[model samples]
Target: MRADPNLYDYWPYRDRPKIVWPGGKKLAFWIAPNIEFYEFDPPKNPSRPGWPKPSPDVVGYSQRDWGNRVGHWRLMELMDRFGLRGSISLSTALIDHHPEIIEACVARDWEFFSHGIYNTRYSYGMDEAQERAIIEDSIRSIQTATGQRIRGYLAPALTHTERTFDLLAEYDFWYTCDLFQDDQPQPLKTKGGRLVSMPYSLEVNDVITYGALAMDPWRYADVLKRHFDQLLEEGERSGTVMCIPLHAYLVSQPHRIRAFEDALAHIAGHAADVWFATAAEIAQVYREQYWDQTVADIEARGLASGGTGFGPAED
Candidate 1:
């Protein structure tokens, strides 16, 4: 069977039901700091290249390594300054190599979720057994080290197979950051159980803005402010979610960190209007209050028959 191209129902954004966040807040704002670890000479997958240049690329390896060694701390300090907590999209092996960084995040009461064992590792071309083992490794390693059961996943480098969602549900994951289709949480069509697609921004992400768009810090800051402004305004009528995806290597440089901080300050200033939340927290509340209604609305619109789940709910 072919996959559904539109992951969710065809609900027009303007006409959808208003989502009222707790405390009548307009926006659900969260930060995801991608605390990653990249191996210098990773095993290759048929679907994707491990590095842009070649194996043992010193410049590429060291640049990403700097995020772990130096840049992450600088980014964490600024998060502290704004009293913001991160939901870390972590590489599982980082717990072994840089336990101190994980320890610091734990101390700040931040949430940790799997981004696979290594940033260089891709989910492409994996069989069901291999994928399941990776999920189990992540769950076990994180629980053993940090004493928290991870409930979210962002596929490494955003690579995934059809079974990815099914496996995540079986392992009891609550949310996924892989889908960029909506500005609000939506029920996902997984096989074993329920999953929520959290609003994770690709456009506002540091890697895209800095690397692909060639945006300088000043322009980056402006774009962030503008993104927030539009969302805040639209959110007054219905609740919206905004995520700022950051990589320590890209945003934590001395030249760029201050501008990023300034943008954070601007968003933080509107504390009364937004609820600063983790992805799990947002998913939990939506599951409790809105999931059934959303499902029902999709059904009413005649758009709920396209999923590939294992049971009768799927077509």
Candidate 2:
């Protein structure tokens, strides 16, 4: 389905300059580690009580087990190895079942972005009140568990509505990754003014590489490296921002976690020229510097189109 025309308009080749990093850094990278759990509840039409039987192509029983144990540990190891903290997009239900994970995340100072109450159950068909309750409950649960108010949100399966922004604003979230309007953080004009849209990359995400392509971790690493290299080259001409979405279950597996490590090492090795920051940090910077009234002046004058395409911005 096409995006709502009234919500945004896209015009490529606008005159907005590339977003420069703090202190003239070449590229800014944001890593998002998502922890998800898919519970099973079959529809009444089905002759089953659980989710529709899983296919080999989709997540199966084997993958679920792998994601919970090996996958979770590997992600932790990668964070330790790279000396990087990430936003953990978590299922509220999973957090309830695994409170230790929440504690661990807090100890590591990781940012937590709600992925929803669970993956399989979505918020799409719910009424306004139901959706609002789901969002508020997820925030309250996370805050109670981690002692940190959730500042960002990622819709389950990226399924949401126009009201999503209003709800997020009501909850006082700093940003949401639901929209892919721009690479650098951009202002989202909501009823309450603006909130930052921190774009998440579907192209570089582990789900596409592993779940879709069925490729090995090595291949995933190669794809990541190629993207990073191209963006670094572009950074010379214009600033670039890259967001890499990772699933705790997919990237945390023993074989795949290695690729995650390799990718992080590749980026960290060049830390001098790259700025690695959380989504919150990115949004804060964009609000203070790029999306302020001065920058809005340029947008208003048609110097730059307010919305770019839904692709991640290259470095």
Highest-lDDT candidate = 1
Candidate 2 lDDT over residue span 96-133, tens digit each: 67777777778889888888887766655677898898
Pairs clashing in candidate 2?
71-252, 240-315
Q: Give the poorly placed runs of model 1, Cα more than 4 Å off.
A: 1-6, 309-315
Per-residue lDDT of 1-315 in model 1, one digit per residue for the tens? Answer: 444544456666776777888999999999999999999899988887899889888888998899889899999999999899999999999999999999999999999999999989999888999999999999999999899999999999899887788899888999999999889889887765678899999999999999999999999999999999999999998899999999999999899999999899999999999999998899889888878888888888787777454434445
How well does candidate 1 score on lDDT at residue 249?
Answer: 94
lDDT of each: 0.90, 0.73
Q: Give RMSD to native, each candidate.
A: 1.8, 5.1
For all predicted structures, in order, the TM-scores are 0.96, 0.85
